[model samples]
Target: MDFFARSLAIAGLSVSLAACAGAPAQSRPAAVAQTAAAPPPMAPPGPCALRPSCDTPFPAPSKREFRHNRSGLLASALGPRHRGRDLFLLPGTPQWVLGKFAYGPADKDLKDEDIDVYLLRGCGAAWEKVGTYRTTEDEGSHPAVVGVADEGGQIFVNLAQVLPGGPLGVGRHRIKMVVAGDGTSVDLFLEVLPAGARIVVTDIDGTLTEKEEALVGDVLTGNHSQTHPGAVDVMRSLSGRGFFMFYLTARPHWLEPRTREWLRLRGFPPGIVHTSVTATGRMGGAAASFKSGELSLLKTATGLLPELAFGNMPSDVDAYWSSGIPRTFYYKLADDARGGVKHDDYRTLLPSLGELPAVCP
Candidate 1:
């Protein structure tokens, strides 16, 4: 069998063993194609490359809030599994994020812009830094970038390697990032969930949130806020039932903090919110491609498929179907010819376990 087909069979075997959650997982010969490979390294850009005035033609920003805007860590839901066909899942498994340095306030720009990121553990005043990570230079692809001003100053930080285990233990963890130049800092939060038999995947816009009939501007701006009724309650119910929730959206990476904050403020259960990093993510097939790709990675990396998926757009249905979620389980907010389960809102959808077999292998 081909690699993907063999992996599916292995996943099926895992489902058959679901009744015996305590049984030892099966072991199999390692496939050469399953090995994890490090990403290719590129030459580090100069320190000030991310600033507007740092380079020719582009000028620094006049506003202060713009200094650190659109900067934070990416979230991870599933931890790395020690054994399985997905043992070596890389890009999506090991926690990583693009870190940006905050510049300017009193027109005093920083020269030494190295950043230090720490993983904070515990809640007391004695909170300790459990891990520290170094940043690798990379170009930012945010769609809102004007000219070439903010492209070069970004860096990628990997937290998985520095954590106690490859996967963080189940709990809430806060990441602290500090720019060595002006002492400016920011914090991002993430939670590692306990292993469960099924996962709940849903789209953000129009699926979980309510959209007005005639609002024409950007629907996913950082400040755009409106969610459907009972959306949070339904997700909370599913979370209580032991299904890991994943929010898949076509929004850009820069809006991650806003999206996360919206979900938190609205009482939704905590889960990783996946967004697009590319400048062209909303164009053409970008959204569908990204959602489908992430779903595929989730399955390939952890061998778990989403037991239930909720979406509104045709792209969502297409992506969920491509990711192997059943049409009956793929619920849509609107009735369409796509043939997935239809729901007016999340109020009536009670996610049930035991429907999806446990993922193994």
Candidate 2:
């Protein structure tokens, strides 16, 4: 079987992709190809370019948010119908917005679909409609991406290549990846971490939840997701002390929205959030591989590493240890078999945690 087919089988997407609690997403296809505007410079690959040092020409301000110009697609011409937010990163992270395209009831790849990316910076009264370009570079046929999307329906774009300026300014910047044919688009948020930021990494799911994360969906008892009694307070204390939060999860990418909502509903501090991109990335031992690799990528491009790490599973142990996180903590594991300092409650450790020197300047 091909890579995507194999991934689907491993993920069991054919039976469960629809059951996932969000907009219907086509099963991820194989890695899409990418290209930039000019000659490839000394830049990290699409997924790892975190140095915010390039740009495409900025588009003008727009009074209106993006919307599909027309909808009814499947006809003599099968066309793209949906878009999805792709990757997130620190500023200067040049990567394509993640997207997929399909047509018809079977959801076949809408090949040769040209995708355009537009940056929307909230202007005083209007959004500065940054230039809509093909690659993160400039407007042109992304020969490789178009070729891949033609075969696979991933309407992806590489990040800020030889755009035209310095990195995107830090803060919340909105980006839209649109089907050039129709206005069908995926709205995404791009955030740049504070320069020279110190990071604290924490796992979600079993680590933070007072009970199984599934309980957050308990419509019967109305039991919203609950964190450990002191979880929020402790995290807030750390945030107050100047460390940035980095939420890592092995959950499938489809759950990212629910994950974000849970974080906000529970009053967690704002920070970078990363969800596993594949089912294999999260299950069993791959969780550690995924998390460790992701942290390594962040450090490679951004030069920032976690000063403290928290996890609740053996996978987390492997992840933290392999990533070289100096200070680590895990929930219920006994003995030193799992590694890291054991902790029973966040409150009990508050004093010592607070005593640690502040991370932010």
Candidate 3:
């Protein structure tokens, strides 16, 4: 099946919102006498009402070094000039490296130059180990080297094969370099990109909010609700960073008003909200199969290629993972590694979110 058809098949969009929310007895539409059907139930004002804490201070930028030899061979590798020239070993050089990692044969000869790299995480006065690498003499073939580099200079600290499972996640990673050798050192910052452009697809339910159970209950039973801790802040951060924030939910599209309001109220930056639509032309739940179909429609409409996806339920996680999003951020009330990677709660994971670079590649 085509990608769109696959997404719709998985989404099951035909589910009626009324059925999902358990329509109120008095409010139910009359089969025979009603002149006009009551307008779809108005969603509570401000679906997203919580705002992020603007007062929360951002961490200071961190500094590191990117030193390379005149021949360009890294010291970690067996070479005469492995240490490379200390590009910014002097007092006035820029204090960060901001570029992609460079690699070469174990014995290939190269130039010694200085470059600037940007640091993604590990900011503040303290120095955090964002990345590390060792050199081996395998010049016959291209040895995967991961580190920071720029127009002036480059530094290779780790082997590329150690990534995804190492400090840098699977796709791309940002790092800081500290030139350490002899009597002088310089700080360099760098951002590493994957082989291809990638995007992250995340969920709004349990993954970003503590009120997962409550939100699900309200969706399934038409109960009033409140925002959860850290939900607004996380969404804001993700939005500010330019991620395509998609508020994908099983809730019906008719809830758009309430959903938009809730986001504004809670300070979630305005984002594209996707929800279910009813088969009879209303909103909300139908059959699980129908809901899956609607999901497929939305996916086709957006044409978003998700590299990573975050969700709470096993089904959602499995669905996204199976669809080709490799990395998964699985959130749970309890910490357990059953179906995927789990977090204690969103807050515990907040620090890591900060680790992500503020700028997108």
Best by TM-score, which number? 2
Q: Decide which is better by TM-score, 2 or 3.
A: 2
Candidate closer to the true structure by lDDT (higher is better), 2 or 3: 2
Tell me model 3's lDDT, rounded to 2 decimals.
Answer: 0.36
Question: How does each model score on lDDT?
Answer: 0.45, 0.54, 0.36
Residue lDDT tens for model 3, 83-128: 2211111112222222222222112332233322223332223233
- Sort every candidate by lDDT, greatest first: 2, 1, 3
> Clash pairs of candidate 1?
14-360, 50-153, 53-60
In the order shown, the candidates' Cα RMSDs to the true structure are: 20.1, 11.1, 22.8
- The lowest-lDDT stretch of 10 consecutive residues in candidate 3 is 81-90
Instruction: Give the count of colliding residue pairs in each prediction.
Output: 3, 15, 75
> How much is the lDDT of residue 340 in candidate 3?
57
What digit string (tens of lDDT, one per residue) describes model 2 on residues 247-334? Answer: 8887654344445556656767655567765423255477778788878877776677898888777778888888888889877655
Q: Ten-residue segment with the worst summed lDDT in candidate 2?
A: 28-37
Best model number under lDDT = 2
TM-score of 3: 0.38
